[model samples]
Target: MKKSMANGIENDWPPIAASRSARNTINPIRRIVDRMKISPNPAKEMISLSIGDPTHYGNMLPPVEALEAILQAVQLPTSHGYPPSFGTLDARKAVAQFWSRSNYQVKPENVILTSGCSHALELCFDCMADPGDNILLPRPGFSLYVTLCQSLGIETRFYDLIPDENWQVNIDHLESLIDDRTRAVLINNPSNPCGAVYTAAHLRKILLVCERNHLPIIADEIYADMVFPNNEFHFLGILSENVPIVSCGGIAKRFICPGWRLGWIVVHDRHNLFKDTIQPGLIDLSSRILGPSSVTQAALSHILSETPESYFDDILHQIQSNADYFYHSLLNTPGLQPIMPQGAMYMLIRINTKDFKDIENDKDFFTKLICEESISCLPASVFGIDNFFRIVLTTPMDKTEEACQRILEFCQRHIKSVT
Candidate 1:
């Protein structure tokens, strides 16, 4: 294929040529996972801590209520046909009611169901920021935040999360990053990669900052209910009055049902700000995708309204037990040290990159470890960090302990001798 010199029509390359936006976007998690193909580790079994999906390890399962609800939904005859563009009235209403707060309650009109939290994020950005505008995010945060922003041609300005301070946002850096073109501030309470939980006070401060800056909050509370026993999960919807907090969440983490692909965006606008502006955009986005699976959509009401608190507590207990085991094991190890995770199913293991002369960065170290030990973890560089890797603790406690053992041995193998 050849391009004309004058008009310069786009190249019609055969079986090739990704668009500029496609070329610019990269899923670092997929990149890291692709290394397993040729890695010279154990063929029969690999202890993979790289995957964030809770179902991979066979430890987590759908609740009886969810499964029964879905089964009942399938027999309803309505589940067979095409679903509503936004979502079922009952489901959307359930989502709104589920996230309602005392001060600023969400209504069904403000909720738009989508495929997953990823889709919710894409939709959120599609409505809020035009191309070339910047949004603030947490550094050492979820890589998807950057990826989702990049594909939309919107810029992502990352503020720091102080690891020493329980991964709380560096407020000064967050404030400094704001500028005229900044449209939104994204918050991932119970952050990915770094299993940090923000306190109510800290989150209120963020809301205050965004409110003062006239920036609406795109709150990613997907892991909202996955906090540890001592930590409480606070919804930004409850905290914000002036700022329009568009909360994106789902049953993926708390209910351990990522495969269902049912998530939603709830506009928690106290003054009808997002309801007027972004709510239509969210609906339009859902219209294009036709919402999440019909059966899953039907189950939303029961899942949100009927699931017992005991089920949630059990899931948290399992995750906390696994996290505690792994964190203690890493701390006891000579070379590996993990920042104790406060929430979510993952945490970061801080590798002394400087001590290991052979390793150039987090990616290099992870690649080598996967090849040598049959243990896999996502490099922290995927989350915009240099010397750490994410350790998913969704596996059973015994398996997590075993993973820690293999990691310690690998660190011992390559760790530089002390002076």
Candidate 2:
């Protein structure tokens, strides 16, 4: 056997290691997205509709006041030091004020700010779960929870989200999966890849299930403010007190500052179950872990406290128009079944690979489309659904039209070639 380091231990793998789950599993979409960096064709211009990045269309500019706050924070002699492990009082209060408008009586004390929603999620997992304790996750959900759980040696079991019926949660299936070892149930409203918003009735069913199981709810409402027609946003915190609920939100999607890397996990248990039981653990975890950027925390006061009412109204209107445009345009395109997205900026469409001779699966379809038409879409296999693709509507209206046209022409060419 090979000698180990000076510490004198022999190991097959390197030290500073993760659990088995972490070592074995890779996020499939992330792997493909990584390899997509370099393109083969010299003349091709790639129109990216795969990632939900809002900067592509140029609708969101950094808030002017936010920049001033960041500048002021950094230049101040006292601001360079580490922020309070739980986040600064000013930032926490601003988060509270922001949530107050939604009628969620969030106290600054209940907020745990971290390095964006990703860290907030990891914090939640650390606080709530132990190895062998699994959490229920949505199939094709955001990979953050799955990744976090794997790293923690906690199991992440998935329940299905029905696609044919407007991507509704299969609550019965969820109930069937939970047991004593199950810690929480995670739901993403205005879902990431699907853009399917949960209704009040859906929330009611989920809340009831959680109450029955004595499990807390992990609600991801990052797209809460980006809602459009036929979909009403429901906050789980507003729904029930029977079970603890941790609601995660950030300025990333709503204000389009993903690079800002600021977000919070708010404890919304009406009965203070989390505060009474889990809050101390969460605070301790956050204290030991590093906090969000001090400069970005400074911007929180401006971004959260002073969001213009019209700014939000215009954003919703733009998203609605874009969703409509993509839905209608895609409906007219053969071999693509566009589910009308009720909220958020994604359109998950089924690719009829059987109709296209060369395509074998979603990956094949997406790869061919990217190589031939220079339009990029995310494969559904990444989202736990095969033979479907997600298209982002963050591009300008004209570019949205052009992208759809390119997809149409590509499909036609593909069909002709197959014949």
Candidate 3:
């Protein structure tokens, strides 16, 4: 068969990838270190106190027994199949059981699994918000929230965490940030960068505010299990009956398996707000994503089902020891003022840039320290604060001590040179 068609002159059309909203306004912090070219890759030997990645000090990696369980799951053909849209039944049940062990009465139906806590946040936002709706987040937070909401065309409003008051959430400022367009408020307890743990009393106040506003609370509790000495970890799910609460958590930081990519977002709305209003949206979103990894889901099942208190006791002991050592190191170091961290792996230090003639800001201090002292640290300016640097206490005990000495020597030399 022969067909005659009118052919038009073809013009070159450019293919564009992603929308304007998807572009990241704030770059990743690691880019600063990536831009440098050092002989023999100095980072191999340098003391890294910048990123909170646990691999720097070997805290997050699991034991051989945990690896065996994961391997066993992979070897089974049944575990290779695509999991349920919400997550595997075994995994969800395990998660529910884990909560029961913690004295919370939760069921498998309440859990929704995702790749990690970050994905859990995305799911929660997608479920709760419409385009142009705002969510309240903490100032100087993880910063990923800004990028995530921006990409989704959702807006984020910040309320300051009062650093002078042990990085507590400023309740008045938080209430002020909420409005008609606000759908939810997010809080990360045992917070990132500053290591702020919200007390039960503080969380109660937050619930009251949310109850009044008729808005849900998104509690990011990935670091829930990492509280240090004298710090109590409060689970919002226990006290979130009146107000709709979406509590996110996972075994990544707690069980040291971030690579496993198993995390969950549980709806704690006993009044059925999330079930009625939010669950449908989350279902639509989760269905399209085809759910989290099947192998990891199975691994999660095993870990959650057999959660040994001994495992956590060991981890808590190690972290407490690490925090203690790092705190003393910072206190002994000259010209650096570090607030003792109650939880998490990082501490922010006030840098006296005025004392160093060549250094003007936190970035400048970080650059020089990396080059001269062979120590890499984060500048707090990136987290909405200036003239201060953040140090990750996740490094090995010996390295922490050594880095503190090196930093002290560098400061002394800089002061002498300036004078």
Which candidate wins on lDDT? 1
- Expressed as tens digits, the lDDT of each residue in 77-161 for candidate 1 is 7887778888889999999888777765678988888898989988998888999999998898898888888888999899999
Write one digit per residue (lDDT tens) for candidate 2, span 195-295: 88888888899999899889998888888857785568987877766878888888888887888888898888777677666888888898876688888
User: For each predicted model, how many residue pairs clash, with residues at least 3 apart or on different chains?
Assistant: 0, 1, 0
Report the error of model 3 at residue 349, Å. Answer: 1.8
Candidate 2, which ten residues in sequence have the lowest lDDT sum? Answer: 36-45
lDDT of 1: 0.84
lDDT against the true structure, each candidate? 0.84, 0.81, 0.77
Among residues 3 or more apart in sequence or in different chains, the pairs in candidate 3 whose N, CA or C atoms overlap within 3 Å are: none
Tens digit of lDDT per residue, candidate 3, span 1-419?
23334565455556657757656444556455566553323544688887666755675466555677789888888888878778987888888877664556788888888888888888888777888999998876876677677667788898888877878889999999888999899988888878888888988988898889897889988888688867888888887769878888887877777777778987787778777668767766878776778887877766665667777777767666766776677666656677777886677777777667567788877887877888888888667677778887666677877887888877777653622
Model 2, residue pairs in steric clash = 140-383
The numbered model that scores best in TM-score is: 1
Lowest lDDT block of 10, candidate 1: 35-44
